[model samples]
Target: MSLSVSAVPPLLPAASYEYRTVRPVHHGHMGEPRTDVLAAEEPLEISLVYGPEEARRRRTLAVTMRTPGDDAALAAGFLLTEGIIQHKAELRAVVPCPDVTKAEERGNVIRAELVPGIVFDEARLERHFYTSSSCGVCGKTSIEAVQAASCPVLPAPAPLLPAALVHELPQRLRAAQAVFDQTGGLHAAALFRPAGELLLTCEDVGRHNAVDKLVGHALLRDWLPLHALVLLVSGRASFELVQKAAVAGLPVLAAVGAPSSLAVQAAEQFGLTLLGFVRDNRFNIYTHPERITG
Candidate 1:
């Protein structure tokens, strides 16, 4: 499903709309019922708008089930991690598709306009981009298939972080998760300086989307090649999370949960410092421990 080009609407702030309602839940032994706030989950259709100004084209890239906040950053980050755009300058603008008349559809369809002269690879589009909430790169057939979609992440030369600083990150990351605090049902991704200060944080129902939002925020701010900072995820590290961090040139990735076997492999292959089970003042470094100092 593609959309035709029209007058671009003013960029709206990314927002998370309520998709679920709270109901009273009665416990077996409790007299009073409790109410719960669930994280909103909805489909966001990401589309690509590119070509010469006179002869432009649009294509629906992917439909992802994500929490609605930071939709633009999610789209931009998706492209950046997919190797569709190497730098922030490649993107002209990310706006809600104006052709959709329904108010509900307005923010759900995002159009990523490319800078003039950059070619859009339709073949690559056919191979990658479509994803689900559980898996971001479901189209990849093999390990090489995944590696082909992204450039190798180079090793960091400076800004070595202390091991103690690394352990302190999860607490800082947890403190910044406002949405998760309310719902207790969202995943978070945070960017941190080597000295242990939080740079930015994003949350979503999908762990991958959270990472994408964080990467997209950095991309929009011209902060690519994030070699001097660490990326921390609130859930167990997966292959897709590692891939996104690697594409953004993030040198260190720490997770509060364990990492999958393939995630560890990807981190080792990309020379990224992958930490797992980072809680209670302890963490296990799965790869590239050299980047973490005493």
Candidate 2:
């Protein structure tokens, strides 16, 4: 159904940093207490606002726990990957909710205004919007439900990447992890060219959130359908990570850790090049091995 929203509030600045203090005990001895910088983990309520200014409607599409920063991209990437919005042009503006009275709620809520005549799928959102940091979907009757909502990832025409280039990606990803370096507590996702050039990197308390932020950044730049890029994650390859890569049209997904059974299955089904244990200049190709050049 087409929804309408009247006035969109000004956009809120992205919050990428948060702090917490902790005491350290090491090697059977008590260490001095210190403040640590951490990736900000907060709930961002994504609302879909559309229609004319005179008559408006707003629906809370999702409330995801993400590391705050690139929130507009996060929300846009979430909608794109969820099959809610197809392209960036469908988005009019993303604004923080002005109705919130609390100070903490200032940047936690954002409304994405869709262009006129675009239909907002309320039922689809109702089925899949309440996502946590660890899981994206909860109630699914069958695999088809999940499959139906997935974005299509087409195979790359030239399916070969140098093994040496692949080996260098994890290091580049690590180099870009500013948050992880300080806190040593955030997961990261990065995009790279086939030749190992790092394009973008994002860190979050949640692995999937990192991927979402990366994909959302790409979405804002009109860089969807990432067929020529390789995606590297700092953690294990989960089904959700694979799904986000698939939605973004990334052909190669490499992880520093192992891949789950479902993750391998999704990669197989979607023609993704899935790699795991991607460290020490060695990695295992779980699916679509043709994409990796030795």
For candidate 1, list the clashing residue pairs, or say none: none
Return the number of clashes found in candidate 2. Answer: 5
lDDT of 1 at 196: 82
lDDT per residue as tens, model 2, 14-113: 3556677888889988888889776667898998887666666788887888777767777888878777877889888877778888898888998889
Off by over 4 Å in 2: 1-15, 19-21, 51-55, 129-143
Q: Each prediction's TM-score against the native? A: 0.86, 0.86
Model 1 ranges off by over 4 Å: 1-27, 33-35, 129-141
Candidate 1: residue 98 lDDT (0-100): 87
lDDT of 1 by residue, 72-128 (tens): 999999999887989888899999888998777877899999998997567987867
Error of 2 at 266 (Å): 1.0
Q: What are the candidates' C-alpha RMSDs?
A: 6.6, 6.4
